[model samples]
Target: MPTAPCLQTILALVPRKRAFAASNCRHASLTGGTTIIQAGQIAWVRSACPAGSGPCIFRVLPLHRDGFSIPVTDTPAGNRGARRGSGGITLDDVARLAGVSAITVSRALNTPERVSPDTREKVRLAVEHTGYVPNLLAGGLASNRSRLVAALVPTIAGPVFLETIEALTDALARRGYQLMLGQSGYGESREDALIDAIVGRRPDGIVLTGIMRSEGGRRRLLASGIPVVETWDLTPTPVDMLVGFSHEQVGEVAARFLMDKGYRRPAVVTGDDHRAIQRRTGFERAFAERGIHGVPVFTVPAPTTLGSGREALRALRLAHPELDVLACSSDVLAHGAIVEAHAEGLSVPRDIAVMGFGDLAFARDAHPAITTVRIDGTGIGRQAAAFIADRAEGRAFGQKVVDIGFSLVERASA
Candidate 1:
């Protein structure tokens, strides 16, 4: 039987009817090959013809006239994660195990604010044993400010931003901030619009996943006077305060690392982002500085996931199997390359050393932990928050640029 490609799956499921035509809908490219639509019509979904065997699905979640929206149900939380029931275990079971009422267990899990410290501690122990995840949306809205901080990542299903996001949420909550998450998915225009809507609702502070912005977006952010922090990428001229290392530096360091490892023929697998472009430029310049010529490159669109990484490896192998090392823009792509290497029966590092950018969870977890340039995304968030908090209190902050350095992490892959 023929396999159902991703494009086919999206095309089949998109609601082509007129009722679902507005662009307020959001799309997130998740890990494990699932795309979540945030309550909108299914606009135009199409698949670009593959240059070779790998297939790609391109969908336009038009926020304006072109793309459509689809209705999205309020997805539940916990281990199930918007999935249907898994009958084996549940919160109620954990509550029973802990000798606490289900309501108390829920209170322990969702809002320890109202519960007694002793009860909260008991529920916590039960949660540890039974693995019960509280439904965040469950229990009617109690407080006026949900303490929710809505962060707009380019994509959550993709993994590059997870560490940063986790750190951000944790840091915010430590200071009594809750998180409401959204994914922009390479949609700058849509992201701009999302920012507008998010700001209108008045989130405590807005954390942008990337630095690049549309002109109108720049203006609105400047005028909003809210504590806005831009992470993941840095700029000399920032909208407010910035906390990120330079992408150009990542590229330069990767090139230098490859050269130090005694590899001459270097190729890059990169996502289409301004920062990634900087890295590529830095890498190329470093290569030229070392008297190496003809740097090979393979480019893919952003929110670089494992799938795209696999495809990039295939393309590079076809064109330059002799290439000594492959540098990827993100860890997701590097992990993909590792998987593809196994599929093709090639040994990593021996056949072609692989290097990825983000030192994400999978970067270390993957077979032959991927060597990468590690950015302190958590540090960025913490510092950004500190700056925002200070600025909000009418305290002065002079330095706009915070250079959180990147370190080259050594592992089996490189």
Candidate 2:
């Protein structure tokens, strides 16, 4: 008898229709020297016979979209049998283990809030057991959506942004989207690098902590056509949408509040961040309008801490003991100033009044309940999420810029 043809020769002889007739075929055992090619719900098998035995055979089999199994095939001496490598664990594996659909598994991972607690726990356990890592890039390419939003903040250590971040995360989860956070530091270079990395990933949306300051970063954002939301700072000309209050207005109001309370000799202890400087300028301008020019200012590095605040207050007192009131850039700094004043036996409000920005929790729980400027951080976060979701979902929205504004909270410290 003639030797059996090689696998490639047999494939060449078979017609494309017969080789790919997956619907007409039934499941069969695969023998030695068999190679399987899978495409969607179809599989093509090529089985080679021994020399002088019989002609090679080709078969098609229908398979579940999620998975399939192949038996180990023994090869003749000095001949390597064709084999398929295990493709690793996948979403379908987790779904099968959890007794749910693949889409349900995906929903549980991306938006657990949409699924019941029990179902979510099942999917979670399945994922944990199988070590299934979601291929977001593949899914995103197929569906044209990553269902992910990227957010950049100046610093994660600052308590002032905690409310906004929490609100953003909650709102996004409710809408079946996830948030990826990045720290842009307090410099242009770091922000620009982060923007570049974020843009390359092509997220559904981007949330920025402040208005884009770098010209290159602004240009990239405008060119990328991604929905952008600038938060915590205001600008008439934003790259896309904006939800923030004016830092200048916050400072001016703090200054006027002290002036109204009969604290005439007022000075400032502020961080050197961009927003802090803007507030300081506003404070000085307000006092300058009343011929009170040259207000004493003590500056600390960005991300001001309690130690810096204490040092600032001490230094300001030594230079201008007449300064009866002090305005601080953050509640952390103001809290320090209050502690230092008490340490020096100076009575709060009576001896040295102190005001702080970002009415954080410590401001309310302080010894004298610090007077401070209150910005609606949660409101900004929710509004920003809404803006990004609307744009991502192709909903028409008229508002591009929103000023959440700020308020003065007077307490015992002032």
Candidate 3:
């Protein structure tokens, strides 16, 4: 049996009563002149003091047979050192475990092609054993590239933006980049806070669902010097690159389509969100231009649900019984309206025509297929990704604002 090395100084000091419990030693109490307590690979050695001199001092040290002492540094009380990486395992720990330099560990993990196969394998096994995860933020700081793109949307519960989100995620992934999604809610207040947080992290790019409405939010994004792509809703003055269509145009076109189909007394059931309001404005303006005024509008809270849609149509019918056509902000709302219309024993298109925005999946497969304004969500996502990638890589992209327009798909519901 190998004898334990003599402890010179205390690395960590604990009260006499708590010392054994803290060190998790096998020994019950300090005995004789010296007491050695073995706990796993660590050994605690207690040196007895004079009767009333003081408490016996316990020095903790790792038990090594080869006499090669690993340097131990004193950490703050109750703190187990700074955990900059996963599971308190640092690059140095992995390197030491692999019997290589810290730089070699980094090179093996990051640029594996530069490291020899044997060295890489050694580092891999050591990393696996230690459960070490590289700190991407630290690595990003050195490289000045996080390889991360952040995207902010109103809400995730609604399927209207699903296509755009999916396409954006796929596109970013293909370009060796990851996306961090944030929900801005349906109001500008939440969006401003999210923008501030995202800017502080300094991601490679930002994809905004709509053009920045707040001047402070816009300024922060601009000052951050990050690549930005605004999508879904269009404006002449964007924060940076823009990929969207005019919501106003969508509403105006829908109005014209309804007029062409000989439906007078048109009404709108829209959410109070900014984009939805813009669509309502455009719809009202188009009707007003054709000498038609006061197109009855019923407003619903944002993230409009099927229940809200049912309630909206019922309220509108009660308020304006003569209204012949109803335009909804989303397909979800339109589907609810159709259901409610059926509940009231009204035939769609014969009794009242319904039009929806966002040509969602269920819109085409409904009882009476919905006629809707189809915005190219996939195109918006792909274009936004391209813009971000181009700007991030310092490549020149010509068009800053690309309006991939919307189309009105005529179906049985209209």
lDDT per residue (tens digit) for residues 17-117 in model 3:
23222232222343343354332223334433323323332333322222132212223222444332222557886787678999999999777889999
- CA displacement after TM-score superposition, residue 355 of candidate 3 (Å): 0.8
Off by over 4 Å in 3: 1-87, 92-130
Residue pairs with clashing backbones, model 2: none
Model 2 Cα shift for residue 362 (angstroms): 1.0
The lDDT of model 3 is 0.80
Write model 2 residue lDDT over 262-349, tens digit each, in one string. 8889889989889999999999999898778889999999898999989998999999999899999999999999999999899998
Please write out the lDDT profile of model 1 over residues 266-296, one tens digit for every residue: 8999889777889999999999999997898
Give the distance in Å from residue 344's predicted Cα in candidate 3 to where it truly belongs. 0.6
Q: Give the lDDT of residue 171 in candidate 1.
A: 78
Candidate 2 segments whose C-alpha is farther than 4 A from its true place: 1-87, 92-133
**Full-model lDDT for every candidate:** 0.70, 0.80, 0.80
Candidate 1: worst-modelled 10 consecutive residues by lDDT:
4-13
Better of 1 and 2 by lDDT: 2
Tell me how candidate 2 scores on lDDT.
0.80
